[model samples]
Target: MRLLILGGTVFLGRAVARLARASGHHVTCAARGVSGEPVAGARFVQVDRDHPAGLSALDGERFDAVVDVTRRPSHARHAVAALADRVGHWSYVSTCSVYADNATPGQRADTAKLTVPAPVEVDNPVGEHADFYGPCKVSCEDAVRDGVGPERAFICRAGLIVGPEDPSDRFPYWVARLARGGEVLAPGTPDDRVQLVDVDDLAQWLLYAAENGLAGTFDGMSAALSRSRFLAEVAAGVGRPDPELTWVEQDFLLARDVRPWTGERSLPLWLPLPEYGGFLARDVTDSLAAGLRIRPIAQTAARTLEWIRASPGDVKAGGLEPAQEAEVLREWAARQ
Candidate 1:
């Protein structure tokens, strides 16, 4: 099979490209070539996808399948328009964030309402403006569907994708921090639910689905795990089981100005709001039925820790600093 992968130089895209090549598919990776080397065993083609003729390099080419890993709607729109005629199948790597409300549990792939007021143009959706990310993706999914027809497209509404070479560092932070063996600051309750898909698993599934002509939306995720169990698994993966976890109340953490998710002062994977109760517990029944498989959580954690150990420079980029966590812990202990 011949495959074309958009944005294959980093993370999930890189994984897909590598796996496709390993499966004996001839792979072409289209990107600007600025984000380091392309995956091994794949041909490289430079295309910005933001510019008018960015996809011109592959204008006359054809492929058995095209996997688009770009986040921008405009790029999806253009890529579909450019390759729709030549590609046999289209697989889009979308996000579960497209769901307008995860406040309700058991939200199915097709039943969940997508974010509205979709972005008309592309821009970096960050910080308080991150709401735009979902809407933009919603638009992208629609564009892909409209361009290639829904029957020819496979839309993967993915959850938090974590593993080795993860640029986000959300899961890696917990794996690396807990290995340090200390009174770690834990947010919310031990039973708080969390869900994430391993990058390799997701990459493999996307390729398999596309090659097999599977269509429609599927949540790319794993079974949920309680906070305590999740941490324990991470400890086991990192070979550190002695860390004294001090589970802190969510309200207290909020009052003390501890933020949720990523950043220097935030606790990754800790959402304290009532509206987010179902956020990490999305229903993946359809995904599982469609042959989506999740690798063991311990394996994901161990692989992530190994990557962080190898590339130690930026391990602390999106996590709490040691001193800040210590100060928060001290203050919380005093209140008790």
Candidate 2:
């Protein structure tokens, strides 16, 4: 199969290109060559998706499938306008953020209410307009579906994607913390839910969808698991099986100004209850049934640890430092 990936330099896109190449598929990655390098074997075509005629370099090219992971609605529209007619299958990597309701758990992609698409005039939503991220993705999804029609389009609403080459601190924080093997600060209740898909798993599913010509939108993530199990599996994966974890209550953590979900002084993957109960607890039954294979969290964690060790510079730095965590634990114990 001949596959073309738009914006294939970063995380998910790079994973897809690497997997596709290993699977003997002829892969072509078209990007501006700024973010990161494309997979070693896949052909690279430097093209700027920001310009109107940027993709003209691939003018007469064709492919069996094209996967695009552009957050900008304009990029999506430009790709559709330029190559929708020639590509046999179109896969748009969207996000679960498009769902209108984050408070309700177990919502499926087909039944979930989506946010309003970005206004036709809005193209690049970033910085001060970062809230438009989800809405812009909605617009991009609309562009792909409308451009290629449902039969030839695959819309993947991905959740928190984590694994090797992850550009976020969310999952890696736990791996690093657990590897240290001390009084680890586990945030929220042990029963609090969390959901994420390994990058390779998601990439494989995307390729599966493209090869099999699977259509329709579906959430791209593994089944949700309790936070306790999430941490234990990660700990075990990183060779710290029986971690002495101190489960911190949300109220206490919030009171101390400890943030949630990726940033300085935050417990990554730990979100406030009720308000974001559904964010990581999505129902991916349909996705699993449709060829989305999820490996064990232990495996994902171990591989992520290996990647972090091999390329420490690549991992984003967030989450609580040791002193901050010790202070928070001290305060919590004092309150108790």
Candidate 3:
């Protein structure tokens, strides 16, 4: 099927575009000539995705599916409105952050919390500060649903999406820190629950939904496990010392108000994972029920570390000096 993906040059967007093409689907990607070049074998549209008006370039272009990974809902609302009548399916990349609850896990679309205070105009100005990021995306989701209905549109609300080309230093920070191999300055307890979806898995599942023209919103959780075990697996992946939890106690960091990872390591596990500014969100029952699942959590995190080890440059971009990292590796090894 012919698929048009907006904002398909970076991060989650890039991953989705690549995965779709690899699966033998015709993929057309659009971005503002920023961050990436066109992927081989896929059509690339170099237009400013932030500008809803730019979308007019594709006025009557027909496609079987459209994948929107843009953060601004206004642009999405505009593009969808323009193309909704022509497209067979709309796969929106929503976030689990829309849920304002943290008390428990297993969040479904029918959950009590509805993402209120929806953005008034989905095609508002370009800057993110005023546009829909999380709450804004919630509004966009509603607009898409209203315009196309559930049967024609699918929302893939994802948890922490981690893997290669991860710009946010959140997950990579752990990989780099663990690669250092010493007493890693880790926050929170091992028992603290952690969840992150691998990029490949998320992109693949998206194609699965799009291909079948599946309706309804779905949560996207790759795997869930305690933080400590999470670190252990990462250690194995990078050939680094397992992050020995200094066990500084969550209270110590809390007392000092150390808000690393946007309190992802310490916040009530079920609440949206905010470290990546709400990218790695939580409680995605809808995502799972909609048929988006993943490999084991241990392997997922391990694969992340393994990937980082293969590419030292990527991790460095996510953190500070390489020399300091060497020192860290030394400490981690000496202890073992």
lDDT of each: 0.86, 0.94, 0.68
Give the alpha carbon lDDT tens digit for every residue of 204-259 in model 3: 88888888888887777754677777778777666664556564444444444334
Clashes in each model (backbone N, CA, C under 3 Å)? 0, 0, 14
Return the TM-score for each candidate structure.
Answer: 0.95, 0.99, 0.81
lDDT of 2 by residue, 253-272 (tens): 99989999999999999999
Lowest-scoring 10 consecutive residues by lDDT in candidate 1? 117-126
- Select the stronger candidate by lDDT from 2 and 3: 2
Q: Considering lDDT, where higher is better, how would the candidates rank from best to worst?
A: 2, 1, 3
Error of 3 at 227 (Å): 1.0
Cα lDDT, model 2, residue 106: 91
Q: Give me the runs in candidate 2 sitting further than 4 Å from their true place.
A: none
Query: Model 2 residue 12 lDDT?
Result: 95
**Tens digit per residue, CA lDDT, model 1, 149-230:** 9899999988998988888858888987887878899999988899889999999899889888999988999878888988
Error of 3 at 151 (Å): 0.6
Query: Candidate 3: global Cα-lDDT?
Result: 0.68
